[model samples]
Structure formats: C-alpha cells, structure tokens
Target: MKETVPLSVTESSEAEALFHFETGAPEAVRAALGLNATRIGDVVAVSMRNDPTRYWSKALGFGRTAAVTGELIAEVCAFYRAEGTPLAVLQLVASVLPEDWAEIRAREGITAGSSWVKLVAEVDEVVARAGAPDRRPMDGLRVAPVEPGDAGRWASVMMRAFGMPEEHYSGMAAATVTQPDWYPQAAWLGEELVGSATVYRFGETAQLFGAAVLPEARNRGGQTGLLVARARTAGELGCRLLVSETGAETDGGHNSSLHNMLRLGFRVAYERQNWVWQPAG
Candidate 1:
C-alpha cells in the first residue's frame, strides 16, 4: 500500500480518464454512435446511442465533490432518460457511498451490480515489480508504442480479447491513439499483435485502461510487459501515480485481471460499486 491516496484524487483521476476516452471519438464517429455526455453537479455521465452496453454509458465519480443525495441521483437518471439511453451504471467511491444508498437505490429502481476494485501504484514500485523474473516471461514478447496507422489494429486486438463487439467501441478506442496526452501500446508476440494497453495522463496521474490480451496469448507475460510499458511511458511523461480498476473478486468467482494487477504492486485503493438503473414501470 503506497501511502493512501485521497478519494477525491482517485475520483478526479478516474472520472477524467474515462470521460476523455468515452467521448473522444471523431466527429463522424460520434454522430454514428450518438456519443454524448453531460455533467450533473460535478458528476460526468456519458451515453452511446448505438451501443447498448452500459459500460460505456455510465455516470462516474459522483458524490465525491458533494453529498450523494437522492436529488443528485434523480438528475443523473434524468440525463440518461432524456438521452434515451435505456440503462445506466452509476459509480460512487465506496468510501463516499451515502449512508442511505440502499434506500436511494431502491427508490430509484437501481439494483446492486458488480463492484470494481480500484488500484494505484507508484511508478518506481511498478518498475521494480516489472523487473521480477516471474513478471517478465522470456517468451518472444515485445511491447511497443502503437503507430498512427496501427490504431485500428490495436483497438481490434483489445476488444477481441474481451470478446466485445468491435463495431461498437473499436473506432472510439482507436481514436485515443491520437488524443493528446494519451499513450497507447500494442503487445506483439513475435510477428502477431496479441494484446493492447494504454496510459491516459491527466495532471500528475496516469490512468491504466483498455489492457487486454487475446485468448491465444494468455499467461505469456504479455500483460505484465504491457503494464511495464505503460508505467514507464507514464513516468517519462512526469506522472507520479498510476490508477486502474477491475471487477472485484466475489465468492465462488475470481477475476484474473484483479490478481494480475495486485501482483504488479497495484494496491486496492477502495472497492467501488456499480449501481444499475432502469426506468420505473
């Protein structure tokens, strides 16, 4: 555990990271996907008209700048409703989840959803972790910066790794390759592009997002290699901290991503809930 980071810092780092990625699509792609976003109080919520998945259509980092009040939640729901986005995920830092969250969620037709374990690491600690023999498999793995022309290929490999439909999110993911302060990388196992990772730098923090490896490329040190790649990139850019999150481990279930992150010196800052909301009947 690196000295604990303030929840407000985690909140801002994460909120800006995801917001920039989700709404960073090109003009035509934005129109094609109906990508849009708005702020409710200090909370930023985004919606995708074409993609039905709630992951990209979510309100995050709320209640950190202010109290988690029912009115605030109502405004959040209204934003989604007006956009006609059928479902939404609301993420509030567990440490800041209002005391009456249960009642608020119940009244708003929100239900419990998966929790995410937020993690952070100092750049130096991660560089040390990456030097571990176990983390640096001797397989023919190499991580390199994604070229301008390779954005599509980079995004394709990442989405494929997660079994996501490429048509919905790949274009936007690729767009990040050119976004300022965004560093995207692809992992190559010999001649084939096997995985992808990215570091989104904001202020003094670098956010780790979109890291994944294909099924055929698993357990070969590609991910750890990618982590090292991004960590170094962030450090070179003068970032002091790296932030990331993955699904929390639950009873009878496990999240390999979470395990991998923990092994790389990323400590759990907190567990944040995903509150699901749908229109009332």
Candidate 2:
C-alpha cells in the first residue's frame, strides 16, 4: 500500500510540495482549480475544487487510488473552516469518494442532500449526431483570452456564476494567474464580462475546469459559446477527449446544461453519486 502522510497546516508550502511529489502532479495546476491541502492526524487530505466528482472519477479511471471515510470529511471541513456549509460537505464527498457514493450516505449521522452525479460528454460523438444542438448560439458573444488587468471582472463573473463567496474567488484568481496549465477565456457583451471558462490539460485528456455564466447572461448563449470554443481549442491542442461535469440536480434535476453538451457532441461517460455528512448530533 502507498504510505499516507499527515499534513501540517502551518507548513503549507511543505504540505503542498509533498502532495505534488506524491501525486507527480503540478501543485500550481491543482491549486489553480482550488484543490487545497489540509493535514489531519497522519493523513493528508486534499480537497479538489468544488464539484470535483468528474475530476475524481477521471482520476480513478486513470488508475489513481484513494480511500474515503469520516476522518477525511472532518479534515476537509476543518481545512475550509466550513462547518456550516452543506455544499462544502457535498463537494468534499465528490472529491474523496466519487465511486463509493453509497458508503458515504450509509454512514451514521449523515444526511445526503439534493446532490448531483457527474456527467461526461464526448465532442466527436455529439458532432456525429444529427439532431437539435446541445448548445445555443450567442449572436454577439465574444470570447477573448483573459488579461491580467481583467482579474477583478473575471473574479466577479466567477462568483456570480458559481455562487462562490468573495474569498473563494480571490483565492481562485490568485492561483489562476500563476498556473501555466490553466487557459482562461472570458465571455463579453460589449465591454461587460458575462461569463468565463478555463481548460486544464492532464496528459492527453483536457479537463474543462470552471465554466460560469452570470445570471444576467443566462439564456444568451454565453455558456454554449464557451463550451464550443473550448472543445475546438482542446482538439487543436491534440487532445483526444474533452471532459466536464455538471450537477444532475440542477435545472429541475435534469441537468439542462448537460443536454447542451450532448448537442455539442459530449456524452455521459459515468454517473457518480455526491454524498455529505453534517456534524453528528
């Protein structure tokens, strides 16, 4: 068995370095996607960005191994000091044990929320299908490479689209500017930032990290434009596949956005259960 090491919060750099070494993955890339590390007892717990079901699922398929338990949950909650957020707990489950979802809910004192299963779509398959397109077109939606000067606008759109608090956006932006693997593009209406998406390449597979559209920008095709652009970019970069995940519960539990992906040639590769445990009574 691979040895597990405890993480020390005070020594963040050391913890991050050790995590990178153990995973043989880039710290900057993980950090950019909000994958932070927290040490609990003798175990190191790393929380991937919110909605990590797809990320963990892909990792498992790629032969990575990890175990999940209440201890991991406690450690993640403590790391974020998010004892009051149900969503945070949900994200922790998605990141830690996407495959063994039933085990998570069966644990004593755990109440599963209206969570989601991860869905994936293949671009080639969608293109081959002759039917209604998954994504809608934006008449004048323009996409441009993110500029350092637009950090504040980009941050605002992320917060609005993802429902993230100010602090999380701040951390995400700080990590984004320094990560080479992250390719950020902003959607604009005239000069107003309306949406944004980021692409992260892991080996030959490119993962779509964050895709958010401001509430005001919804139904305007901002998201669809972003997805299509990213898919084309990923293909041009020599990636054989492009992947992303969305909440199965969103859009009245049908995942309307996922349908858009299907229209664009992505398919559901797997369904993962998202589980969470609140503080025991």
What local distance difference test score does each model get?
Answer: 0.84, 0.53
| Stretches of model 1 off by over 4 angstroms after superposition | 133-135
RMSD of each: 1.6, 9.4
Taking the tens digit of each residue's C-alpha lDDT, what string does model 2 give over 1-281? 31221111112222233343223334554444555554454344445544333222111121123455555544554554442322333333233454654554565334554544443445444334423454345867788778888866786687668776644444445356346556677899888988888776554455675688888777777777787767666666776566666676555456667777766766554444434444454
lDDT of 1 by residue, 1-281 (tens): 24888877777777888889988888777887788998778798988766755567889877666877888988898888888777888988766777888888888889988888889989888888888766547378888999999899899998899888888578889999999989998999888899999988988899998999998888787877888899999889999999998888889998888877778888988888888888877
Candidate 2: clashing pairs of residues: 6-42, 120-267, 121-266, 121-267, 122-265, 122-266, 122-267, 126-265, 134-260, 134-263
Per-prediction TM-score = 0.94, 0.63
- Give the worst 10-residue stretch by lDDT in candidate 1: 132-141
RMSD of 2: 9.4
What lDDT does candidate 1 reach at residue 34? 80
lDDT comparing candidate 1 with the true structure = 0.84
Candidate 2 Cα misplacement greater than 4 A, ranges = 1-108, 123-136, 249-254
